[model samples]
Structure formats: C-alpha cells, structure tokens
Target chain A: MDKRREVAVLSELDKKLINLLQHGLPVCERPFAQVAEQVDSTEDEVIAHLVDLKERKVLSRFGPMFDAVYLGGAFTLAALAVPEEDFAKVTEQVNSFEQIAHNYRRTHYYNMWFVIGTESVEEIEQVVQGIEEKTGLEVLNVPKLKEFFVGLYLPV
Target chain B: MSENNNIALTSLEREYIIATQKGLPLVAKPYHAVAEQLNISVEQVLSMTKDLQERGIIRRVAAVPNHYKLGYQYNGMTVWDISDEHAEKFGQMVGNLPFVSHCYLRPRFLPKWNYNLFAMVHGKTPEEMHQLRSQIKELLKDVLVERNDDSSQNIPTQSNDMLTSTEILKKTGLRLKDKTA
Candidate 1:
C-alpha cells in the first residue's frame, strides 16, 4: 500500500525481457550477461532494472525455492487467533523464530498464521508444541493432508 | 525438484531478496535503487534475479496472500481418505477443481485415518463451501472417504484434536529476541 510505488506497465521490450528471464537465467557464472545480450540491455542495466523491480516488490526473491522434503524435513501450515491487545507482542515473538518463516495478521478466527519448517516430522511436531507453551492460546496446526503443485507465477 | 539440483548462492544475494519479497520499490529506475543499496551494478541485480528464475530457484516476483480483498474471507480445510493407490490420481483431479485451493496426500493410520486426500475450499458462506466440497467428493470415483453426516468433515483423525496446541508453541519456544524500539 505504498503510494511511492510504480505501476507495472509491461512494455513489449519489458515483456520480452521478462519472458526470457521467466524461462530462467542459464546456469552459469554470468547469467545477467547472457540475459542482457538477449534483452538488448547491458549486463549492468539488466541487474539495475531487476533491483528496481525487486525494491518495488514486483519479485518475491531472486534465489532458489527449497524443496523441504529433499532437505530431510517437512513442514505444516498453521494459524492462531491472538487477542487484539496482545497481537503486537505475539508478532514480535513469532517473528523471532527463524523456523516459523513469517507470520501474517489475517482477518479470521484463526488469523495469526505462520509456517513451520523443521527437520524431521518429530521436530515439526516439537516446534508446534513449543509454540503452545509459549503462547496461552490454542494453535491450529493445519497440516496439509495432501500435496498440490503450486508456483507463484503471474502473467504480467 | 531435488536437492542435488541446487546451485550455490552468496549471502549478499540472499539479503537482497529478503528485503524485497513483501513488495517492490517505487522509482523511474527501481533497479538502480536496489543496486545502490547493495553497492552493485544495476545490471547485476536484474540478471541475478533473472538467472535465479531460469534456474528454477526463484519461483516469481509478485505480491501474495491478498485473499482479504479477493472476497474469499471464508475459507476452511477439507480432508479425505482415498485408498493409497488412488490417492495420487485423486489429488491431481481435486487440485484441478476451480473451487479447490489446496490439495495434499498424507500418511494415515488406516481404518480410522483413511482420509488421505485433502483440499481447501473458500466461499462466501459455510453452506457454499460444503456444496463445493460435496461436488469435489463426487469426482473421487474409486476413492472411499469418511465424511461427516452429523457435522462438517473432520480430517482423518490420527489425532482427534484438530487444534494442535502442543505443536504450535515449539516454533516460538526459544527466548524472545530483544526488540529495539
């Protein structure tokens, strides 16, 4: 909701650049250099524009998304409903834990949602328990009963 | 896809990403803004991100979880118990449904925990959600599931307690970090 932000107008040139980048930067030491040649921008300009778009929050992260299962661990998507008065304190505490990923304040009975990424199912279970003793409120551990393949992609 | 498929990355690159995940910056040249912070060439930042996408490392750059504005204020989890053999197929079919937001297959303890196929349905009202789930249930041809007759369907109970109080606290179990006001 920042007014200083710019709108994403996909020019043909910009679209082509994004299309090539979307396919992925090749696996190499100098990926931007390659993309630059393809996008008709110098490597410096390509990186500069990317940084700009990222600063504007157009891109989520410019890094690999992990496969938790392959990393010898699993996670559960969970939430809770903290009282309004205690929300800020809980947010600070919730945000402190690296394993919790990030917590968001949503509009619902179960609103204070956070993700748990931990080693082993046992660890995952333990993390959930630890969250309970720390906070008096009950936590709704909504573990996925099944898996669905989803990627964060938007056709700009 | 696999851990072995992973390529190494630098710390600065990781920092650049974490700062911008929530939203993009505003400027005629936002890339320059980000580059200035990192003290790197603007082109490097763009290509680093572009490369990450190509390598399948970064998924995409976009805003997320704006569900509130989307009018899906009502959302609930729906779990199922399809036979193991049919679970995978059922998940694919269930995920394809427009009403189904998420679907997953998890290990069950059998007899009691037969509902392995899970999907989430969001609607304006509880009844609307039920209707959508009911429709998806019909698509599970060979899949047998224990659905609620008296109440809404509960996830196959390996644990009868749906609100997992014990496990939830563990993540925040550590000492609270100091906050600078």
Candidate 2:
C-alpha cells in the first residue's frame, strides 16, 4: 500500500458514486446525466469525479468489459513450478508472449500462475507447449470447465 | 446463455468493439463521442451496445476499481479439492459468497494438483482474508468429511490451499480478436 499512489481520502459523495458505478453505467445518450440524478450531482461533476478517481488510481479502468470467449477467443490458467534460482529467467521467458495476458507469482510449489489468451484453442495449446519448451517446466494448463459465477462485487 | 453464438460481428459492430476496447471516452457524452469518431449515429452506438450486452459479448460497462489501491491489499487464489460429484453444488454455494470474486470449476491434473474449484478472495489485510477463509472452510467441512469417508485411498482428507500472489509478473487487458497467432 503506497500512500503516495492511493487516494488519501474519499468524500462521502465519492463513496456513493463508486458504489453506484460498480453495478454499471447506463447505456444511453445522456448516461452521465442519468448517473448524476441518482447520485445527486450534476453531469459535469460526475464526469469530473470519474476522471479524478481514475487519476488517483482508485479505478484501474472504466469501460466495457468484453468476454473473450464470446468473441471467439480462448484463454486458460496455467502454472509452472520454477526453481528458486531460475525464477527470474523463467518469468522473463513466460511473459515474452503477447498472448500471455496476466502472470502472477503465487506462494506455492507451482509458483508462477498466468493466463493465456489467444484467437483460438489451437493457439492456446501452442503457447502452452512453447512455454514448456522455453522454460523446461511442465505447464499446468487448467481451462475453466464451468464458470460458477464472475460476480466480482467488492463493497466500496 | 449460449456462449458460442458463432455469429460474426457486423462491420459496424467490429469497429465499435475495436474503438471501445481501449475504453469508452471519460466524458459526459461518451457514446456521442464514440459515434462522432466512427461517423455513426449516437442511437446506433447505444443500440449496438445494448445488443452486445444482451448477447453476453460485453459483460458490463462500468468502473473497474483497483482493489489494492482501494485498501484491498490481501487477495488470494483459493483452491479446493472437492469431489467431482459434489463440485457443482458446492462451487455455486462458494460463488454466491459476497467476498468471493471469481469462482470456477477447472480440470485438476493428477499427482501434482488435485484442486478443482478455484475462488478468488480479496480483503483489506491478511487477517481479514484469514477470517474469510475460515468461513469458506466451515462451509465446505461437511462435504469434505463425507468425501473422506467414501475414499479408500491413503491420501489425506485435507482440503483447500490459498495461493497468495507474491508478485504480479505481467498484466494487460486482452485486445479484441487479437491475431497474434
């Protein structure tokens, strides 16, 4: 938690506004105006607050969240257990792929977990195999068989 | 919803997705600005967005807060080894929890891995996350016990491991229909 990067304080209105925006923004011509009415602020004020929130790093991003699967793309959660000495080299090799959307170092034997997204299932396999060839570590490719839910609701 | 519609996006829809994948304009009239950029009507932009949402191609147009920046520093990828028969019911129950962000039933590779259900949890601190983990453990205790009795293998009946992220190696939004193959 870097104090300099985080927002020092959130006004009551900002809190309420964040809570409202999480559900979603209206899809219309005057969308901000609609949000303004609900949050009891002017349209301009709502837009300004959104900009300020993003700049302060409170909001990582604000936009349409597209589903890659629906768009005919494929993705998988894969991991590798890199030896302590080769961690840096392995990380560099794994992240070199543009298709590797996200990679995280977790505290476990299979320490390096990452997501691979590509145009199709074939591409996903190629990337996974390529990773194994590059890192000399077996890749644990776990594709989601079923999504119970993706409701990422964190109460502000 | 049928995830694989196999219906191709119209040229207009393709343009819309490519334009907004970077994110909608953070202005009062975001859609209008988008329409202006694409030389399309504002109504067409609104209608297409609605259609995409209905089709599940677009999950939502909303504010994605930085959980770490918002005081949620403790996040864990909690993995559980639920029996195949009871996974669906249990996974749904875990997904419904307010603290669980994303829950999924993924394939488990034998010997090295046995966990099938993955749930992501975030909290203000490790202590807070521990409390949430306890709640999850309590919820799954009964099923795990039942599973233990049915199994004849020498494997211990222990369940669940929380993999806390030590570092974020790389992160970037997936581009729409990226042709990097």
Candidate 3:
C-alpha cells in the first residue's frame, strides 16, 4: 500500500508559505527572512513552519535542486519487466546499487521503473549493463531526448 | 543543451553539493550554518551558490513538497506514441498545459516499448487524473499514432496509456560519491 496517502492538514499560512517557497527562496544572508516578508509572517514563524513540515514529512527536501547532467553526472529513466516469482530477488539486486536513486512498481508490462544517477555519462551505460546482468532482464534505457517542461509546483 | 560539455563542478562546488544535497539546515541563517561547517565565509557560500545557479547546475533553491502529502494522491506517468515528425510540435502543446508537471521526449525500444513522449500528471483523485489525461489526449489527437491492433508486429496495441505507481520500492536523494573519501 502507498503509505503517503494520508494527507496532512495545512493551515492557510502553511499553504501560502508552501506555494511561495516552492518557486524558490532568495540567496542572501537571510533567505527565510525574505520568504517571511513575502508570506506576511515572521522569520521565526516561517522557519518554524518549515521545520514542522519537514518533520511531518510533508516537504521531502528543502534546498538547492541540482541538475545531475550539469554537475558532470548522468541520469536516465529505465524500466524492467520482472517475473512475479523473481520480483523480490530482482528488487534487492537492483536497489543494492547505490546508483539506483529511485525505484517504483508501476502498473504495466514493464513493472519495475527506476532512475539511475551516475557520476558520469559513461557510468550510466555501465550501471545499465550491470543491472541487466544482475537481474537477467532487458533494461529499457530511455534518457530524455528533449525536455519540454520540468517543474513541480503543487499549490496546497 | 544536448551537447554535454562546458559544465563541470569545481572541487569546492562539489563539497558544497555533498554537504547540502540532503538539505540545508533549518535555521534562520542556513547559509551561515553551511559556511561555518565548510570553514568558509558566508559571502563565499552565497557567491558559490549563486554561481552554480547561474551555470544551470542548481535548478533552484526551494522546498520540495511531497505531492501525496499535499492531497495529490493519484499520479500517473502518461506516455504517448507520438509520430516523430510532429513530436516536437505536439510535445510543446501538451507541456504547456498547466496541469502537466513534466513532459519529455524519450527513445522507444522498438518491439517492447512504443512511448516516445512522456508527461507526468498528478491529481487528487482518479477521476481528476482521467480528465487531465483526456485533455492531453485531445491536444495530441492529431499527432498520436493510431492504435495498432496488429498482433503480428509485436507492438503495443494502444496509442497511449498511464502507469500509476503502486508502491515506492526505493526512494532517495541523488548522492554524489566523494572522491576524496
């Protein structure tokens, strides 16, 4: 079961802060202060809210979102179709690799989907080959040929 | 942007990423905390962060709220078998939709996989997701490949489909291995 289905109740101020902060916070001596000003709250209050949100697992991360490729690394969205009997073992093998950043079970013929983030472009291929050998399954290596849009802004 | 060159993180920048990749300290002066930890001045941290952003390395310094916690429980990876000729044109149209969070063009694995355009859509419920999917379908109606029901070709029978994640097996922030270690 999806454990995150339980929704967290948000106050009006929390929603306002989240909507504003998702776009970004300024880079300065007091970034939270700037956010507080825009959200019509005190710096301490803003920080408190953020701390609460993080503790509650509402905000997964609060920091700079780095581009893997730009940082001399490579990442690709790959998928695999594992036999039901071997699903558990294959998952352990795939997740054991530190390069596998995220793995999910989706409803499809190609059930297991994971993202491989490596230190270099060449390393992406190496990891893919490793996964294929480990699981004995064809890994669909699909790196983005072109990105039309990439942004996550969900208004609470 | 296709050409992967002219972008390399400096040693200090790498250290900065390693230090803060998980997250910044939840403090009034988060940068100050980072600067103190790295044994650098606040000005240096600020400047380095700004430089990274300017170089397109750091997409943004922001808060990433979990959509599930925000009432967006239904999320789908909506993929389409778009014609290569009109993929770019139709991709842009679908991406421009306010509900679409991410849209991209990816290579198709001929016999096994046929989706070329991928768009991620999130909604509070299944009905909402279906509606949003319909909107995208209507926008790409002209370019979407007709359903290939031919079983002989070994291709996907549908023109488009949505993959709803059933379980999150593993999830973690991208970690950059430390070379000095």
Q: Provide per-model DockQ scores.
A: 0.12, 0.62, 0.69
Which stretches of model 3 miss by more than 4 angstroms? A1-3, B1-6, B153-155
Better of 1 and 2 by TM-score: 2
Give the lDDT ranking, best first: 3, 2, 1
**Lowest summed lDDT window (length 10), candidate 3 chain A:** A66-75
TM-score of 3: 0.91
What is the C-alpha lDDT profile of model 2 across A1-156, one tens digit per residue?
A: 446335337887788878888779999888899999998899999989889988887876777888767656777889998999999999999999989999999988889999998877778889999999999899998889888777566676
Q: After TM-score superposition, what is the CA distance of residue A137 in candidate 1 from its true location, in Å?
A: 12
Model 2 off-target regions past 4 Å?
A: A1-8, B1-7, B145-157, B177-181
Tens-digit per-residue lDDT, B14-59, candidate 1? 5555444433442234566667877888788778867766654555
lDDT of 1: 0.55
- State the lDDT of candidate 1 residue by residue for A1-156, as single tens digits: 323233454455555555455444453445567777887778777777766555554543353343334333456776667887887777766666677864555544455777776645677777777777777766666566546754322223
**Shift in Å, residue A148, candidate 3:** 2.0
Candidate 1 vs candidate 3: the TM-score winner is 3
Candidate 3 lDDT by residue in tens digits, A15-132? 9988998899899999989888898899999999999998988998999998766656678899998888998999999999998989999989888999988777788889999999
**Real contacts recovered, all predictions:** 0.10, 0.74, 0.79
In candidate 1, position B169 carries an lDDT of 32
Among incorrect, acceptable, medium and high, the docking class of model 3 is medium
> What lDDT is obtained when candidate 2 is compared to the true structure?
0.82
* Each model's Cα RMSD: 9.2, 3.3, 2.2
